[model samples]
Target chain A: MTDRISNKKNITLSIIAIIVMLAAIYVLDIVIKPTSSWSNLMTCLEKGTIYALVAVSMNLLNGFTGLFSLGQAGFMLIGAYAYAIFAIAPEDRATVYQYYEGGGLIHFSLPHMLQDMMGGADAFGGTIGYYLGIILLMIFAGLITAVIAFLIGIPVLRLKSDYLAIATLGFAEIIRSFFQWEGLGPVTNGSNVLRKFASYDSSIFPVLVAGICVAFIVLLINSSYGRAFKSIRDDEIAAEAMGVNLFKHKELSFVISSFFAGVGGALLAMFQNNINAAPFTSNMTYEILLIVVIGGIGSITGSIIGAYLFVCCSEWWLRGLDAGEFLGIEADFMSPGFRKVVFAVVIMCIVLFYSRGIMGTNEFSWSGLFNFFKTLPKRIAAVPGKIKAKFSNKKHKKHTENVKEAQ
Target chain B: MEFIAKWLPYILAGISVGGQFALIAIGYTMVYGILRLINFAHGDMFMIAGLVMVYMATVLPLWVSVILVLIITVVLGCTIERVAYRPLRSAPRMSIMISAIGVSYFLQNMALYITGGLTRTYPTIDWLQKNITIMGASTKMVTIITPVLTIVLVIALVFLIKRTKIGMAMRAVSRDFDTSALMGIDINRVIAVTFIIGSFLAAVGSILYFSNYTGIMPTSGSMPGLKAFVAAVFGGIGSIPGAVVGAFVIGICENIIKGLGLTTFSDAFTFVLLIVILMVKPTGLFGEKNIDKV
Candidate 1:
């Protein structure tokens, strides 16, 4: 009776936490007024939210299920194209006719309810309705990707982790190459589909969409099924012995992860108003993996935090490259590619020193919040001491200890 | 007869490329054989070696550039083992594999940053670029040289593994790491030598590859690396001669697909082949069928 009561309390607390997070996001969406310059920043945040969703979903497989997959981008591609085909306005499609001349012919007739929901098929018809349509399209995209993931996972997931990584990486490449083919352009719009979609002027829609998807996934993870997933991750053999269906759980997690990745892709496409095979390359997979690794594998909140830091750091680092101009070193010392170089260096340092990543499997909790406030005084008082500790003594000892432990 | 006549040139080209792949595949197989890690960064090492050769040729004479590239690649290979891999020698195989990927990404991105992501062209060495005709098919002198060199190196590698003291150490380490260490082998030195030999082979393959292709880019390693990895897996990852055979098969199959008017699908063909092979024989063509120990 006591255990049951505690379990109930735990569920209630988690629900309250999720509601609070959603409320905060909603407030932020309203507070951050759109300006011409700040619009890009807002969009970046929106895009970051989408990436956070994808990263979290990927963590389900990579972090929780212990399955190393590179097919996230492929799933995203599927979702982006599906959402585009389903949601683009008919008149807007005509304007983009030159690029997508055959698009109209390929789209099947929409269901009456969907047409009504989309405000009678006209461009910019009921604002709320169109918004709803976009959400539906994103979900549809996720479902389609989930189906594909299910089909692919059955045979491929049987392979061991390393081979699985190689196989999935190859699968992503194949998807990209397929999208690049001119013959498949009728449905895919090939490389030109990005230009055909309507851009969302407000960043709120994407943020809300991505946030909801992430929350749903988090809820799922905290459920009994989620414990099964964690069990598989901790030890597959043991999990199997304990009556957990290994193949079933793995497939479920894979499909769910791929589904969210697809939704994230659709949201990404909506934000950019255009996407190409170029951005969704193998590098994208690596970048997502970096986010997972840098944030803390198996932690959803960590994935979110890591995505924000990574995107912001990359932007700031890129901007700082030109800051050499202010210092009078006008020799073009830092090229644009210097950002990736710096990013790689940072990743190496993090992998070497802080292999558990920033959050180290810890989530945002009340106690953590209290600790942050408590430590603020000491952190501010001895900034130099803290910096020195991070670099010279503690970090080196930690890295060496990790290396020894690994060996 | 007509099909054979029309396909002969494509077949020859395929074989030439296959020979080049075979050279790189040996590196992957040997490393996997010794340590059950895939060495994801092998392709990037090849790219770096090509860059080194290009840089050296700019300053030094052709033969000297070639020799220096080989030496530098071997040293770099040994350094990678010592720094990135040696520490993770006792970690889970998956962790080492992940580190290998991290190292791979680090090398490629570092190259990207340094080289500005531009395609670097090799200086036209008069002899290397010379063309030759065989059975009415036009081919580069490098293509012919690649096969000959590949065969010689494979023979040499096989003999070294069979006869050398270090080779025995490598075999022992592969069979059981702690046991070999107990036998008083200088495990670190042997591992370094293994990496050096692997890197040396990769360097040779890179030179021939870039010479024939005429260009090198920061991202050039990814596709070749992936294909070579697949070849390693196809041949029973830890088997040396098996990797060679797998490389030739992949090269020839890819070429045949291109020759049959599916140039766009050639890259996909390799993965499709891997998936099919994996489904049919998970341990690979020549892999030892081991039961799950756990």
Candidate 2:
């Protein structure tokens, strides 16, 4: 009964906390213009949310299902392209696909079409229609990606660890190439970048989307299917023995993970206000995997925390280092690439020493926080004594050495 | 005659590039054979070798820089294995692979810092750069030299693996790591030697490869590294000859794809082939199949 009550309380607390966070973000977005020097914070938050979604989806496969897939970038590419192609304004398609004959193909904007049906852009209904249309398009993008993942997963999910990794990586490369191919110029605009799409006006949009998606993921993780996925991760043979249809569960995890990855990719396109196939390389996949690792692998909350920290560090905090001055220390060696080098070294240290990362397969909880705060005084009070004892032990050793010398 | 003339350059280029890939693929195969870990930094080590040669050539003679580059690369490979991989020996396989990736990221960033993200011109040796005509096509001396040199090195390596005591230890270790260790084999030493040999071959491959290309950048090694790894997988991970054959086949097919006016899909073709091969024959062309014991 206590567990149930606490669970209800935790849910209420989390909802309130999310509302406050979103309110703060909305206020900040108004206060800080995009042109401001401190706009990196906004950029980081927006990008962080997107990366968090991708990282969580990756964790679902790698950490929960024991499938080492490196094809997040490919699915994201598909999602981005799917959204970008349809989201492009009809007028802009001419210039966007200028290389193609007859001013490109499929020239109707989904949001515009919705707007027209709801009494045009000046009406409140039209505005609601526009937002709804974008959401629908995002979902459409995700569904398209999920379908592709289902096809790819058919043959790929059967392979073991590293082979799966390479095969998925190869598929990602193939997808990238397909999008860049000149033959697909009519639809994909060849290798040229797709831009001028409908984007969210504020950071609140992505925060809301990513927040809801992560909550869903958490709920899924606590579900029966999630338990089946975990069983497969811990031991495939045992999972099979327990009647967990191995291939079915594996495929389901892959498809679901890919669905969210697609949505994340669409959000990323909105974040950048442009999309291209070239940057979706294996390196991008590595970056996402690293984020998942930095956040403890199997923890949604950890992935979210890790994404923000990674984005803030690389995009905001480390910018000063790249500018040749960090924390008021300016040196000749502190050039453009120095930040990345230092960042890499720090990552290596994390990988080598603190391999469990910030969360270590643990989720954040209100009770855990309460307990920590409850024990804070006692833990802090013992620090001085511990330090004194350590110092005195060293002193005593030195005294013993001196006595020995005298003898 | 027209067809031969038209395709000869692409074929020749394919063989030459394939030879270089084989040299690097051997490193991956040997490392994976014993360690069961993908040494992701191996490619970066190859890149570093090119960068080392570029910088070293400015201060020293070409021949001296060549030797120094080889030594430095070998040292780097061993150091990475020690610092990044050795501590994770008892950890999960994922952690070690992540460590390898971390090392790769570090090396690439280090190179970026040193080179300031500039594409450094690869220093050319006069002999390797000399132009020659083969059949109806003209090419650099390195094109012919690469295959010859690759074959020679592979033969010597094969002999070392087959006829030498160290080779016997390597075979034993790859066959069964724990049993070989319990049977008085110094696992650390054998691993170090394997890294040494791999890095040395990579350094040599870097020299030959850079001689063909115009410039070397921090990220240049990644594509080749990945492709070489694909070759290693194509040939069967643990087999050297398999890696070589896979590399040659992939190289030829890739170039042929480029020649067929599908330049964008050339890189994709390699991956397509990889997926097809993986689906049809998961053990690879020459890979030995192992039965899973539940």
Candidate 3:
């Protein structure tokens, strides 16, 4: 009964926290009217939410299931393209598919189609109906990707670790080229950029979508199924000994993770307001995997923190490392590619030294944060005494130097 | 007769490319055999070898540059093993693989930093570019040269693996990592030798492979490297001859698929083959199956 009460409290508190965080984002964007720094930071947060989702999903497989897959980006590609195809406005389809002259004869808009099914504007009283249709489109994107994952899982789930990595990596490459193929111009718009979809102009759309999806993953991880997956990761033989069906659980974890990756990919597309197959490369997969490693492999909180760290360092603050005119100072050799060099170096250090990463299979504890805050004043109070002692020590040194000179 | 005439050129081309794939696959197979590592950095080493050739051709004559490139690649490969891998010899399989991935990233990004992501043109080889007509199909001299060179090299490698002292040491080491060490075999030296031979073959493969493809990028190695790895798996990973045969089959099938106008999915075709192999055999055509120990 106490456990139930605490669980309820935690849920309510986190929900309240999420609402507060979203409110803060709205205030920053609409009310404060800060400069490019704030705007860039907001963009980073939005992008970070999507990455956090993908990274957490990756963690589900790599950490919990012990299945090292390199196929997240491929699933993301499917989701992004599916969402874009369905939700793109009817009029913009022609402009977007300029290379292929109106995206073939079977063009249809997902939102409008759903709006019609929902009995048009009179039924939901206007644009709300259209918004509901877009949400459904996003869900469909995830479903399509999940179905593909089920098919892909049948062949690939049986392979051991590195073999699985190479196979999935190969699959990603195949998927990328498939989207870029000139012959598929009707459905995929070929190599051309996909645009004018129902994008998340307001940051709330992505936060809600990515947040809810990630929460679902977190809940799944804490369930009995998650325990079974963890057992497989820890000791597959023992897991099998415990009567856990290895193949079934592995497939389930892979498909579920792929579903969330799909949803995250749709969120990413909306954040950027345009989609292209070029960005969904193996490098993207590597980046997300790096986040999973850096964030602490098994911890949900770690992945989120890593996502924010990655976005902030790569997008906002660490921009100074590369910018030639950073802080009005000219640093010539700090060219554009320097950040990538730096990031690679940082990952090497993290992999070598802090392999378990920041969280190390631990979640961020609310009590831990609260306790640190409670102890803050005492540490701050010690600062001035230490400073005074340093000054006195410096004066004593000066007196000793004077005595030496007089002698 | 008309169909044979039309398909014959593709067959020839596939054989030529397959020979190059065989060379690279040998490297992957050897490293996996001895160390039980995928050696992801092997591809990047090949890429660097290509870039070294491009840079060297500008400063020196082609013959000297080629020889110099081979030496540099061998040294680089050995150094990577000594530096990145030797320390992780006793670590978990996961850590070593991650370390290999890190090395690949470092090499690729370093290349990017140096070249600023530009795709550079490969130096033209005049003699290799010479055109020949066979059965109403015209092709370059390298098409004939690549397979001949590959066969000779494979013959030489087979002799080394079967008939030499170092070859015996290599076989013993791959058979059992710790037991061979107990037998007074210099494990480090044997591993270094494996890397040297693998890197040497990759360098040779890069030169001939680029001779046909004609452009070099920072990412040039990744596709061929991956496909050659697939070949290595197809052939039975630890067996050199298996890697060679797998390379040829993949090259031919891939070319035939592309010729069928599914040009967009030719890359996927290799993976499809990999999946099928994983499903049907789990091991390549020649892979030795060992019973798992608890």
Candidate 4:
């Protein structure tokens, strides 16, 4: 009875902690904003929230489920394009604004339904309508991406890890190619979607939507289904023997993960107001993989932590490369590509030394937090002794092996 | 007749490219046969060999540079086996495969960092650049050379595998690693030999490929590597002859698709082919069927 009471208390405390954290984040968002910089701060927060959403979804499949997926960007591309098609104003589509027209295949017409549904040449409605349209478009984009993921996953998921990686990569390339197709240009805007969606502020929406999506994923991860996901990750054979229908669970997780990824992609589209095939390449997938790996695979908090760190590292930390006066470095001394060089090195170093990632599969728990503080001094004191013992054991083993060889 | 006249040259060109692919595909197939691990770094090795050839050409005569590059690449291949793979002999298949990918990424990045992501151009050899006319059709010297060299190499490899004691040891090791070790075969040496031979073939393929393509980049290996891997799978990943056959099929098919004036669909066509093939034959065309023990 006391144990049950304690469990109830624990749940209540966790709920309170979540509320506190959200409140703290909101306060920080406000505090960090300079009087003149309120809009930009909000924009950054929104963008971060969007990345957090995708990272969390990626974590569900790659982290918790142990699936090495490389098609997240592809799904994102799908979502972004879907959102663009559904939400773009009809007037914007028929505009005679040409970027560079010396072309062999210059112009195409939008389908009648797309034209009519977008209110037939007057789709840019009032502010409330536009916002509502954006929300509905994002959801529709998510569902569309989920369906694509389902189709791709059905045949491709039957393959093992490496094969699965290749298959998914192929799927991503196909999707990218599909978007680039001239035949689909009328709807996709075919390398020119940015100009069409220029009026909408994509930055703010990404953060808000991304944040909400991350919260939803967190809730899902803490559920019974999440436990089953972890069980499958720990040992697939054992999980199957335990009556976890492998394909069904994998398909469900993949679809769910991809659905959020599509939404995240929609948010990303809003940020840039441009959807091109180049940024949605394997490199993007690799970047996400790096985030998951650096954060700690199979941990929800880790994915969020990793995504924020990665974005900051890419945006702020690497911003130093451009600061020639501060570092006493000339413009020529710092190659524009130095960020990638550094990022690659960091990934290699992390993989070699801290393969388990920062959180090491452990989530943020109050007890864990208390334990960390309590054990800090003891761990520090014991480090040297542990190192000495490790060396001695290694030496003993080597000596014994030498003696056995000699005999 | 008109279609044949228009498409035959493209088909032939693809076959020549396929021959180059076959050379690379064998390496993938052989390594997978023995280890059950895809050597993702093999493509980078091909890139490195091309770079090595470009460097060697500056110091030596053309034939001498080719020979020297082959020898150096073989040594590099053996060294990679010793350093990266030997220690991980007991690790999980997935870990080793991931390690291979890491190595591939590391090599490609290192190349990019060193070269500043610039495309390296090989010194123009007049003979290689020259076009050869045969039966009212024109083809580059490299195109003809690629197929001839590929055939010679394949024949030599087949003979070596069928007739040599070392080849028997390789077969034994591939069949059963521990049992071969118990039978007094030096597993390490055999594995080293496998890598050396694989790298040698990759070096040869790289040289031929660069001669045809003219410009080589750090990422030049990835597409070819992936295609070769797909070919290896298509032919039955563990079967050498199968890999060669798969390469030709992919090369020819891709070229035909390109010939159809749908260049954008080339990659898609290859993947669709892979999916369709896998659905038909999961173990691949030449792969040995096995009963699932579990």
Best by DockQ: 2
Supply candidate 2's per-residue lDDT for A321. 84
Off by over 4 Å in 4: A1-52, A94-128, A191-205, A234-238, A318-339, A398-407, B51-84
**Distance from true position, residue B35, model 4, in Å?**
1.8
Cα lDDT of model 4 by residue, A250-349, tens digit: 8889999999999988878777766676568755776677677778877778887888877776665565653432255567545554655666677666
lDDT of 2 by residue, A1-407 (tens): 11223778989998898889989999999999889987998999999999999999999999889899989999999999998888887888888888998657788889878988997889999888888888999999999999999999999998988888878988998899999988888899999988888877879999899888888888888999999999999999999999999999999999999999999999999999999998898778888888888888788878889899889888889988888889999888888889888888888898899998888899988887777777889889999999999999999999999999999
Better of 1 and 3 by DockQ: 1
True interface contacts reproduced, per candidate: 0.50, 0.76, 0.61, 0.22
Ranking by lDDT: 2, 3, 1, 4
TM-score of each: 0.89, 0.95, 0.90, 0.86
Q: What is the interface root-mean-square deviation of candidate 2?
A: 1.2
Q: lDDT tens digits, residues A1-407, model 1? A: 11123556667877898688667666766777775554446656876788888899999899888898878888888888777776555555555434656544454323223546666646455555556666777788899999989988888889888889888888888888887776776666656654555445566667777778888888888998899999988888999999999999989999999999998998888777877776686778878888888898888888999898888767642555534442345546677666667677788667666778888788876555656877889779999887887788877899899999999
Q: Lowest-lDDT window of 10 residues in candidate 2 chain B?
A: B268-277
| Runs in model 3 lying further than 4 Å from the true structure | A1-16, A31-35, A112-125, A325-332, A370-407
- What candidate 2 gets wrong by more than 4 Å, as runs, is A1-5, A382-407
Residue A364 error, candidate 2, Å = 1.3
Q: What TM-score should be assigned to candidate 2? A: 0.95
lDDT of 3 at B197: 97
With candidate 1 superimposed using the best TM-score fit, by how many Å does residue A245's alpha carbon deviate from the native? Answer: 0.8
Cα lDDT, all candidates: 0.79, 0.91, 0.86, 0.77
Model 1 chain A lDDT-worst window of ten: A104-113
Candidate 2 per-residue C-alpha lDDT over B25-100 given as tens digits, one digit per residue, 9 for 90 to 100: 9999999999999888888999999999999999999999999999999999999999999999999998998888
Error of 4 at A51 (Å): 4.4
